[model samples]
Target chain A: MTQSHLAPEVMARARDIVALYPHPRSALIPLCHLAQEQDGWLRPEAMAEIAELVGITPAEVLGTASFYDMLHTEEVGTYVVTLCTNIACMLRGAYELLHHAEESLGIRTGSTTADGVFTLEDAECLADCGRAPCLQVNHRFFGDVSPEGFDKIVDDLRAGRLADEVPHHGTLVRTERDGGLRVEAETITAERRATAAAMAERAATAAAASEAKANG
Target chain B: MTVTDAPKIVTSRLGYDDSHTLERYLATGGYEGLRKALSMTPEDVAKEVDAVSLLGRGGAGFPAGRKWSMLRKAPTSYLVVNGDESEPATFKDHLLIERDPHQLVEGVVIACYALQVTTAFIYIRGEFALGLERVTAAVNDAYGHGAIGRDIFGSGFSIDIVVHPGAGAYICGEETALLESLEGKRGFPRIKPPYFPAAIGLYGEPTVVNNVETLSNLPWVLSNGSAAFTALGEGRSTGTRLFALAGHVKNPGVYEVEMVKTTFRDLIYAPVLGGGIPGGRELKAFIPGGASAPWFGPDQVELPLGQDEVGAAGSMLGSGSVVVMDDSTCVVRAAWRITRFFWRESCGQCTPCREGSGWLEKILRRIEDGEGRESDLELLMDISDNLAPGVSWPPQQTTICVLGSSIPSSIASAIRMFRDEFLLHIKDGSCPQGPAPHG
Candidate 1:
């Protein structure tokens, strides 16, 4: 049964995510990603729906959700601007950009704007040290960002002029799969299965031979 | 010596036009290593790698071949590439993932074959959207080319790779914690002795966890033979390493240098690398590794860049992230920012790390803000000692992961090396550098 909070397509995708791992519990993180992908944030009902789908309790889902910095459990703005103020970025004038951001938005870090447009956060390290003083608008990077560049980005997003610039929070990347490599248990062919068995035998023999050689 | 003088094995094809594409990868005679590896027995492949002494580039510098051999030759073995390059001022893995993803893919596939890992995962960090996109595209391309997935190149061996994107946790950079995060839980590091990823990991099955850069070296090592690879570097610490330069450097980027053959001084001063610190400012201190490593003064700049040499010089070559600070930069402020990063990123699984990092951040902040107490320095050391007992080298008696140990590494080192500046902060009851906080 599809939950009211989750789209049918999203629920199906969640099931597919669960199938990615050997155990359903292993799908918890990905399923949360799916939930956030659909709703932009993990609401209480959304978490409950995901927990039920993954055969876990809502509390367990929340516990996992709260642990990750990305999987927000509350409401946020359409555009989440995360500025890296960690050691590397801090060295490269990231704090100045942060103060600039705070001034431009008229909102401090960790708070959303009154217009419900932007949510600014002071992130630790986005790990883009090569291009220091970086920021991410809805999880996509704006590398080597300047105060003026950040302002233009904000203005563009506000005006919806930068339509394709920033992806939503949970949209990690755009990938087109031609449907190669069927790894699921249901898709293992008979020939492939026989080959897998032979490979295991070969591995054992090869390992034993190597160990003998080492000992000698 | 310049970074160009070092053999560039891992990043050889880094800037080639359309390098991320499989077609371009093939034009440069890529996947020949996978083909060569496929011709040999898995054990023989592992043996060759062991002969090369390919060290793990993911901070710990563990032997990659030894790690592969340690895996139980089972069909259930899993290969998880730790693409979570979350350490502050470190982005070498980011360079690999974004620029030459197929190198990582080819290397990972070869590793899976040798270690008998049928399924693999590349846990890219959340912020790296382009990396995620590029790696995902590369994996898909690998599948399309029959490089990975069922009966690889008609060898009758089958394996599949999946790109798993992590949702931002620095602690997940630790191997066990990475596995925990991969298994869809909080990024809490599993206690060792009872839990190592190789023997028992990922659903209590045999798993091999390697760094992106470490795996990316396999194709080169396998193709070129072990001797050719090992000839480039000093004893045991074989092969070239990617050193990321940042903070007051003229050219702040990733550079490949031979292990131990290159010195920190050369890395910073060579015109081809860091280019002698930006703005002609005198170098005061630098963290040879990422933020977690102990900071060293200018007197020790000649220390070798190898893991052993740096360790002997009372610092680590951890992750090979060299963050330089000029004389104009305040040590107390730098220490506070670094400590604050550890504080914010602590997973809170271990009490010492969780509480101790917070305490360190608060104390350092107070000291930097000119609210220093005379007793606070001693208290900071005491807390660091509690987190990493004795404040010794190769930090010990901490949490499930070395993150607890990492918390005190820079803090204790900063207090020891720049005690005078910290004392000045206390004596003056404010930042001694000037009105500006960062300077």
Candidate 2:
């Protein structure tokens, strides 16, 4: 394996990441992160370089990189749409959302679109189960997404409207109030609250029922 | 009424009407464990833990007290609480961390005080943002109350608790891999021997890595003494285990019980446990441990649920996460989903695990999708056999880590218990259980 294809900046970042760990070989993960951040995907030569930088054999680096689901080893589209398909999300139409995405994009899960603009992959629980049927475009989350809503977002992205980057928690809406900046409190609509409460209640009921059956 | 017996090990003081709150914890004598531990000699504390024979809650089941004893020789020791809780079907640690953060915090303090460590880290899963916040708040409260950080309780014992969030990697749940991530790197678990965390761990200092539930048991052990803790369970495996029950159960959550006291039938038929399968359906099979263990079908002896019994049955009581499968579940499909999970999360460190997991996943997926080859079933078995224990990989040919062996154990168990089900998937071109979504 060759180790000379990496950009100087990428190498510098990898070196910095490697320095963060006491053992250089332990830096393989962070170095891969830097490689992904710079090149958008882990190339063969880059992986080899990471192995050399981390003081491990190329095969060892490849082995570590391939075990995790999140690390992208191959080339991906400009934007990656990762859908959460864990149990919590599965109950909330995540399957339907995934199917809708596959249909709309004309690409299967783990495959990039023909245009090379989007790649769809199924992810484990994204911890946003409170708002299920969620998808992430480049690390930004779009929660409580319906099929139509997802299609609209994809269409917007296709038309070049960059998805707004927001924090996972806290409010997204900001407003100016009398010469000062004010962040809008998240409004819990009656309908949304009712739906959320109902979901919680259903989960509790299911849990109780499961416990009862187990004990009985 | 006078009760003279020793208290239970894990749940001796836990589970009294939603007593997860800090106030309730204090009222029920929670932090007293830490106080009691702080007054004891570190060596004596380690001995007591060793004598009790408590094991790791994270699938491996290594003796906890022995692991702590191994860390005693390191000059600057650190205690790491493995809060990753990433195993697919396991949720006990999540409950312990989310519902009882202070108890875990108290345990950390006790462990640190015993080991004479100055710092502790909680490497929580990135998906557990809420859990992270809860634990971080609890740690802050402990610091505020002078229970943690510089000179805790004026005993000259200082410890700092740092919450390191993992970037959603299942493999990092392994201790060495967690240390890598804590050092601001990607989370790849290291092969043992030369890289065991105890000796050459975390910047080359002695480190003690324990599961969240294992550490949570520390306070009780400290307060009640080793004899009391050991009295709860059968020989060797002492204490209560928090079984995270799920799938086809009337109730699916964390339940604390004595290690060997509960039976498989008791957990299944008991209305408060698993509700005897769903809709009066017969229990077809169950993953006695987490996703990594082998499946036990109805034909298998319905024995007591414990480490010894489960191990004797050729599976482990891993993480105490019992995932039940009813008659409605197709074993082949279950195996496929589980193989897919391993393939997706293999960490790709070894060829047998990385390539073999992918192969198993592909074969199982094809079989599930009605694209079966007659030889694929045998091929699946072959691949699994290659990854099984005693099998070696290239460079050494022997398997590197438990991650490599876990999937094979599961696949073999699935095959042995449900061979007919696998054959049905290949012959009928569809699951006999039909097209229902698995929970």
Most accurate candidate by lDDT = 1
Cα lDDT of model 1 by residue, B29-144, tens digit: 78999999999998898899888888888988888888877786555779999999988889899989998999999998898888877888889987788888899899888888
Output candidate 1 Cα RMSD: 8.1
Per DockQ, the best of the predicted structures is: 1
**lDDT measured at residue B342 in model 2 versus the true structure, 0 to 100:** 77
Per-model lDDT: 0.84, 0.70
| Minimal lDDT window, size 10, model 2 chain A | A171-180
Residues B70-93, candidate 2, lDDT per residue (tens digit)? 774755777888988877657777
Report how far residue A128 has shifted in candidate 2, in Å.
Answer: 11
DockQ of each candidate relative to the true complex? 0.42, 0.05
CAPRI category for model 1: acceptable
iRMSD, model 1, in Å: 2.3
